[model samples]
Target: MTAPIPTVFIGGNHEASNYLRELHYGGWVAKNIYYLGASNIIWFGPLRIGGISGIYKSHDYLKGYYEHAPFQGSASRSIYHVRKYEIEKFKKVNSPIDIFTSHDWPEGIERYGNTEQLLRCKPFFRREIENQELGSLPNRTLLSHLKPNWWFSAHLHVGFDAEIQWHGEGSTPYPPADPSKLPSSVPTYPVQVEKNQDEIVLSDLEDNSTDDDSRLAKKPKIDAGGEITNHNEPGCNIPNKEIPVYPPPSTNFYGDSETTKFLALDKCITNRRFLEIIDIDTGSEETKPHTFYYDPEWLAITKCFSKYMSTAQGPDTIPSNIIDEKNPDELEKAKAWVKDNIKDYRILDNFAMTASGPPPKSCNPSTNLNRFNRPKFNDTYLYRNQQTTKYCQMLGIDDPFTAQCPENDTVSK
Candidate 1:
């Protein structure tokens, strides 16, 4: 019988932690499966100048700190710290690591096109891609040297229809590889020195060429020096009254008749459906009331609203109590009722169904009760401790969560 191939998936951040927990509980945790790194690994320090001075105090502290820490100061120091931490983690793992999976494109693989723009605009990213000197980072270079046959990553979101090869030299953009001609190699084992010899092949299953092509076609043409030029102007602007300001005769009608206004609404609604209900009297645009149709799949609106009524607003403005705290017996019954009826029991009270006035500006209107239940702001240190404890408990591993340090105990004495 063929031996199961060892796989190591590395994901850091909240989304990854949730996914890992689901995978573990869902019976997807295989004997060969290993989480190569911790979920909440980034190290953020205080804004104070000397805060980072005493940062690297211990191995565990330093590991957790730098994993999520910003890559500032000399590139060499940042690269060395990150690489050292990652390599140490890899070494500490007893499992035969073969695959390296991540939610991000390993350092240097982000330079295909518009990477800078994408990174700048992206939300919830722990570190800016620009601050990360991708080519200079040891992780990308060393990954090639260590030679994990497959590297699975997802943050880019766009699919790769054809297999792409990383040259391993630097940020070299190359054409996509033909999937039909791709070779299949035996899964590498720990002792397999030949593992690093093979080229890393990215799966084409996630390729989104149709969207890419459409985006590319829409990109306004630029001159050699990268300046946009108006193709319509002969040399410069030469106003001609005969020429219609708007193209397409169907939309450029000068007459202010009922038919013209109706045609205008039809044309505008085709692009912006929200323009369907323009207030003629107020000269304001409003969304049609009928546009807000009920979607049965929307759990927040369907489930929460059906069972619960909105509560009166308070001075401090906290969510009204969903369970009867004074009565423990009733609380248990309420919890049981929620668990049995609701699709996501953990999130029932989170949505704040009883809260009055408009929700917080940052809050998504579409967010369900379960999503709101989890606190948005996180206390990193406390979160890390809890995550570590939970991970150890779930895996039946030794508890790694530490309280007061040995030095603190000595100081107290």
Candidate 2:
């Protein structure tokens, strides 16, 4: 049987960590279904899609993936939290992105959309919005760093839209000459700029590739530094590095200053706007309409940094001085390696059931556990799936999540 549509998803706070851990490099979870891994950049036709799975928790953000199944205490919950290792990896991207998704909304995003209406619809969010502490801070940074044409998120459970216009320091987001014509409810946030903070360069995206999608076309050369404002300077300590920063693309398919469209959706339920069909123009560059490939640069970054992954340890293994546009040799070498090693870049719609289904309803052979099973606090066994082994072998990197599970002890978390 064949599925009607293709679906790709990222991890949220709640997921089957035990199973998801197997395809850590992102693989077909099922026929027509793809998991985007911990953090990844995948290509669908002319669209370059990238994202990081998991929500944010400052403590677990830098610890790497150290939790195992039969999770104890808060391990099950904390295991799905976002990590710095993945966040730092995205900072290495130097190409234009078409779409980016995240499980949680970016922090400070409330300022860009109409907060008052959001509060009216979901009043429970008022406290968090008022305290200015809603959404993941790291993801917010990634949003500013990788200014994709379209950004979609799903944590807030609301139908909202906002346009973020990337502008220089002295530029205004909108024309100040006509405040009277602007609707009061147009934004729940104010167009104010942050003052007096150290800035870090995110990308020096210098691509000259010819594509019909103006957003992905050859970008004009500009100054070599772009800055994303840092709000929560406490829990987030962005490393200072020397990377080139360029302004948003001068030409856009929409025919305006380079901007990103942000949308957040609720869960699909009766009378809820959870499902949205977005229409996009792939330009004249798409070879196939229903195919996706690996982003060469992202693959390069992944292969280059795969050795630094921390599956069962503290501290992020990826060095602070990671490769960026300034370091072209390392990236070129990895890209070259990918071309030589990865025979087919296309992501085939194929799935393999490498393991058995969950214990058939509680840990009992008679029945399996429910989504909210009683979490164990001490068992920390790891299962190495054949999918992960092959993925690592192909990438030429050591498999990080290879702890052995006990014999005859077949309980899935």
**Counting only residues 3 or more apart in sequence or on different chains, how many pairs clash (N, Cα, C under 3 Å) in candidate 2?**
13
TM-score of each: 0.27, 0.70
CA shift at 373, candidate 1, in angstroms?
A: 7.2
TM match of model 2 to true structure: 0.70
Candidate 2 lDDT over 1-413, as tens digits, reads 34568778898765677678877888887788789988888766556678888877655555768777766666776677787778767877767777899988877776677765564444445666776557777877787778788888886556777778787663324321122321222122333432111111112122334211233113332211433312111212111111111211111222222777888876544555677788865454324455667666777788888878876646665554563355656656887887677766666555777555555343673234433453333234455566666777877887676544444443333
Give the runs in model 1 whose Cα sits over 4 Å from its true position. Answer: 1-83, 91-98, 110-132, 160-398, 404-413
On TM-score, the leading prediction is 2
Looking at candidate 1, the ten consecutive residues that score lowest on lDDT are: 46-55
